[model samples]
Target: MDLKTASSLHRLRLVSAPEAVSFLLLLVCSVLKRTTEFNAVPVMGAIHGVLFVVYVLFWLDAWNRTRWSIGTAALYFLLSVLPLGGFYAERKLKAEAENAVIASRARAESAVKA
Candidate 1:
């Protein structure tokens, strides 16, 4: 992948897990609000909301840069909604970025030899 695409993917990957965590925390806080006096729903909700927006923006950028197919884009979008799915998305994105780096290096090495 090109540098822009790689960077976008990196950004998305970086946000994915944290976004997932925030979502989980928000859910927990919602439960706590109902069951106990400990209420952090507003705070957690805002945090998760910001992260979700950031994730979506980054996702869009990565999708645009990489020219992913409809299925691939849909999969990523779906992952954002499902609980704990961000972790899986992060893992997948990391692997993809690593593979891109490896391929980029191989191409560079071959060009140097030529």
Candidate 2:
């Protein structure tokens, strides 16, 4: 694949877990703030907000560079909102990267043979 696609995919993979963790932490903080004296929601909210924005920008870049179908792009976009979605997206991206690597290697082997 093109370098832009690879770069965007790599970035998306990197941010996925961090964003998910931040989301879960923010959720926990929200609950705690409501149920008890604990109140870390503001801090967690800011962290999650930044991560979410980064995730969205990476997602858009990947979509544009990778030329994903609308449906595929929507799925990735939807996954960002769901609490556990980042993990899933990360897994999918990793698998795609692996497959891309394998394909590239196979192409290289064939070129060498030729």
Top lDDT: which candidate number? 1
Poorly placed runs, candidate 1 (over 4 Å): none
Write down the TM-score of every candidate: 0.94, 0.94
User: Could you give candidate 2's per-residue lDDT for residues 1-114 as a string of tens digits?
Assistant: 766788899999999999999999999999999999999999999999999999999999999998899999999999899999999999999999889888888998999999
For model 1, the run of ten residues with the poorest summed lDDT: 1-10
* Best model number under TM-score: 2
Q: Which clashing pairs does model 2 show?
A: none
- The residue ranges of model 2 lying beyond 4 angstroms of the native Cα positions read none
Query: RMSD to native for every prediction?
Result: 1.1, 1.0
- lDDT of each residue in 54-74, candidate 1, tens digit only: 999999999999898999999
Q: Which pairs of residues collide in candidate 1?
A: none
Question: RMSD in angstroms, candidate 1?
Answer: 1.1
The local distance difference test score of each candidate is 0.95, 0.94
